[model samples]
Target chain A: MSEHTTLSDLEAAIDNTFATDAQQASVDVVEPGIVTAVETLSMQQALNRALAEVLEENPKALVLGEDVGLLGGVFRITDGLQKQFGEDRVFDTPLAESGILGMSVGLAMAGYHPIPEVQFDGFAYPAINQIVCQVGRMNYRSRGTMPMPITLRVPSFGGIRAPEHHGESLESLFAHVPGLKVVSPSSPNEAYHLLKHAATRPDPVIFMEPKSRYWQKGPVDTSADGYSPEGSRIVREGKHLTLVAWGAMVARCLQVAELAAEDGIDVEVLDLRWLKPIDAEGLAASVAKTRRAVVVHEAPLTSGLGAEVAALITERCFGTLRAPVERVTGFDVPYPSGDLEDEYVPNIDRILFGIQRVLENRRG
Target chain B: MAEISFPLPDLGEGLIEATVLEWLVAEGEQVERNHPLVEVETTKSAVELPSPQAGKVVKIYGGPGDTIKVGDPLIVFEVPDDTAGIVGTVPKEEAPRRRVRLTAALDDED
Candidate 1:
């Protein structure tokens, strides 16, 4: 039998044997229809609503992951989805990461949009082969004849003290890869809209969720057109230095900017929501105005996504820069134990240090 | 009533110690099966440990900022013999029921 046939048979056997009626009944069904009013929701809840909205509007979209069906995902982001959508659309799969990505590619090839959750940042390693080789290359390899619409959900970043492999800032790996679009949201409002955009886009998107900010709440305007993933947002505007960050670090940068303001230094904070197709122009513009720049992230310093942003700012705003771009990031080591994690991960002090370095280097 | 001690569980691989972040249930308070008893910050993540069975919070082992190792006593609960199977034995049906209720609550908010 063909490899696809074998996988299909295996999936069929697992579904037939394990997916019971009681499991379906056990999952609660949320009332249909999207919430239109402005409401405060945690990042997790906002992402959940975004997933539900996508599944509601697009019949071709389906969610599949381990514990996604009956358990509603480990983070409960997929809660109430299986019951509303049914087994075929929102079903659980065996604990095989490679199979998950491979099957998603096949599903996309068959004209279906599949949003598969990796469950955690570390678990994604097993499926890296499929993600980098197949999913990222399919559309270009097909000479534009094939369109792959797949959103891989990854819960990432530290600060929650999650054990090994659970808290990682691995977006840099995917961002370096050519065909995938990497997007991370720092707030609930951004999570809702960016998720909607990622789901609807006709390309593969690695949606990294900053797990530390999962419970961080903010107002989400459901009626507004969710911002496009093509550009960056100037969340806080200032004149002395540009603070560029995304995911969980955005909040940290804002806090750093607030602290800088008390010292009479106005810092402009830019959130690079889209990683792969980074907003080079917008970032350059921000740096040009501020004349100094600092990039912050929880990932390590060497070749981290922050390095790429720093390089881009250098390339675009070289003539206008008063100081070299500085990066604030985790050390170049494996994420340490919980006791040492606070020191390992970049905090407000480290970010402020970066800001201070750029300011000290500023041309008088 | 018999008092049972619940130890801090290993949240994930190689987690040695965790900080007691907050007490979800205070001492002398009644808690139902599966109700969250305490929130602890481990190396992996911040997790709320649920009460294993219906009981009264007889004593909490640590205060906020106290570091607790895996297998260290976390909470002490007093429970009647009939309801206490073990320190943390939650009813099988209660898990799904809680999920359903959470979904219902979110739906109401929507």
Candidate 2:
């Protein structure tokens, strides 16, 4: 030890720790069957099964995060994975979001597909540096020669009634990043397929799983079915007005549509699955048919994802639109704790009112 | 020998009942603590209930698709007389933030 450490002194100490020459091992990753059977699964089970299938199909794919391996994740989305995949493939890292993502960047560069979990949406703040600086830019920095095939899973949105830092709606932040592709699945079937597809992409994908909808059951036709993971889809069709939403809000919009039907309002529910690389064509077509639009989300109003959806609709369907696009979203404030969540999140009544705003608006 | 009944627990806040999806362990079989006993689908999520303690399965009260109330007996086990004590549902005021630990945050199965 020295009173003042010099650069050369530090370099010499690091050099003494290990050999200078690097020994790189070749990785042979094999792709197995994705999925084939049609069955019912809760969103939690579907996400878990999707990760299992991803590991089974791709030998190079690795799952790592805080409590992800040994604890199967706080949400149990990766339950039983450590036992099935062995420690080398599915392992836990310390409670460090930045380190987890930094490790993913290094692993991805070394020819391995890393699927890292951030544990919670609020926890992702620490990893912003690695995500923005390395994961999203490495491929471009290397001129497409080095592609970062990383799918970072984040359990997002509120409704779990957990304490502070447990629930967050972070799609807008991730979507704002230039090089990241964002996708949120509303159902078990979409979760299964989207996760499988997202893992195979060459670019980085921010896979946001709606925490609240993780247990909602739905039929998943595992054998290559209708919906593609790249764009949005009209889950429920109507001709009067369109309700655009993603994640947990999609289900809420569906409920609103059901209630609006009693009042002769034919509301169409469109699940905007992919937040980044926004589906311009799909949004245009859906709103064009209905001639009116209302965007719903759990995120706050100022700079929320709903604003983007409304802007996209306005840009794409301005000529055909009968009324201004409405946004029904959480109030502009920090997301509150469990007791106040019901008031913060957009409920059936809030969405219905947004629908009314659009439906009642006239050219005058 | 002593017989003890384990009631279906309320998996989530305000959940009153759940539909039995399956019984992982059958009656007349030996089981250990933490062994998954049954799967039930509540309004919130589908979760497996683990054995409260090591014992012989004496009886199971509910079948698949059967609705079991939160405090109703779901299973029964026979244990050595000396080891038996109060088994289920600590009053709300006395309960800790967490009591069950076999989950995958569903508690540590350790």
Candidate 3:
């Protein structure tokens, strides 16, 4: 294939994988079969289906953001939602992130579960004041009398060659703020369930989507099962090292675990689905078993979400750890251009290096 | 040589069918494992299906623009007995690796 053809072909393959997964996911939700019948779906499609389901079940739920109405969002996460739910329920607002969020807070105050989409992670900076100050603190401010049911969706993380400010992994920033539940789903199954859970909650939630994994496909059981997004889960069981990650990095960790297996090292993978109010107990249990831990993320290392996770692990599993916790993360620099993104983002080699560092420090 | 019928694999979650956009390889053409075989588009994105093993394309299933279901056979590959494990048996590791951007700026190696 020509260079141009190859590039586009690669892009197409990624897109096709997500699309096919979404199609399969629809089957599970709509088809009448055994409750265990699972369907594959891309992360993006799963989120879309979750939004559709939320609007369908909850009449008070409203979805609004720039292009969410006619354009169906930049990534089309809200595609056909307006048509299904009408212009009032799924509509667009001014291109102001702060305004969108501020309005969501007001709507929530009026008893509406407002699910607003902040077009991109970088663009969310404009609305950080509202998110951090009002949306996050409203329930606490009211002394439990009032609850803010706003699920702000921000498509985040690097990779996919997006422009500056488009691929920011700002989950750490939100998780630092008090009273906000921060969630980052890694797969279609988690994305589908976690989004629904976020919408149903009485508190404000920052639903960070790893934009890079929008097209990543996986199996999803849409059988009205009880899957809570409240805590972390050990996705893969191993005894050598514990890999803690969320969003896109979970897949990377799983891949690293596979590579580590080649070297006879058993790696347990933990998906920290909920960033804020992290499952400290679950994380501690996994670390206690493995005795070595490595935190991974697409965000920059300094004060990233990984730092909080590492601190938690160190504090809880201090006596059990065999070595110092290592972190595999993006460099502490502005997200690089598309051409140099691979260099900026963590990959298999970097994660392996982290595992190796922990192993080298293992107590004899 | 045994014939392996390569069906359209699940492209992503919930995808039941896809439309053939283009054929990268032709019937009677030789292909190696992981070679691009066809381009298919679903509702989400365009994807290129790769060959599972080294073989000669014995038959092509659907023409461009034809919609094929998940289990529909897309290609028939004639391969040696040892290579005939299953069609669309591309290893998970063969999938595209995420390029790790060099962190020279972060390193102290001047």
**Could you list the chain B TM-scores for each candidate?**
0.73, 0.76, 0.74
**Candidate 2 iRMS, in Å?**
20.2
Instruction: Give the per-residue lDDT digits (tens) of candidate 1, residues B1-110.
Output: 54567888888898898999998889999999899888889877999888887888999988999999998888888865323331112112111111110000111111
lDDT of 2 by residue, A25-75 (tens): 233546554557789998878998889988887888999998787656766
Compute the lDDT of residue B78 as modeled in candidate 2. Answer: 87
Q: Is 1 or 3 the stronger prediction by TM-score? A: 1
TM-score of 1: 0.72
lDDT of 1: 0.80
Interface quality of candidate 2 as DockQ: 0.03
Which window of 10 residues has the lowest lDDT sum in candidate 1 chain A?
A18-27
By DockQ thresholds, what CAPRI class is model 2? incorrect
lDDT on C-alpha atoms for all candidate structures:
0.80, 0.80, 0.80
lDDT score, candidate 1, position A103: 96
Residue-pair clashes per prediction, in order, are: 9, 3, 25
What's the TM-score of each model vs. the native? 0.72, 0.72, 0.70
What lDDT tens digits, residue by residue, belong to model 3 across residues A58-151? 8889999988886567676787899899999999999999999999989988878899999888889999999988887776666454567789
Model 2 TM-score, 2 decimals: 0.72
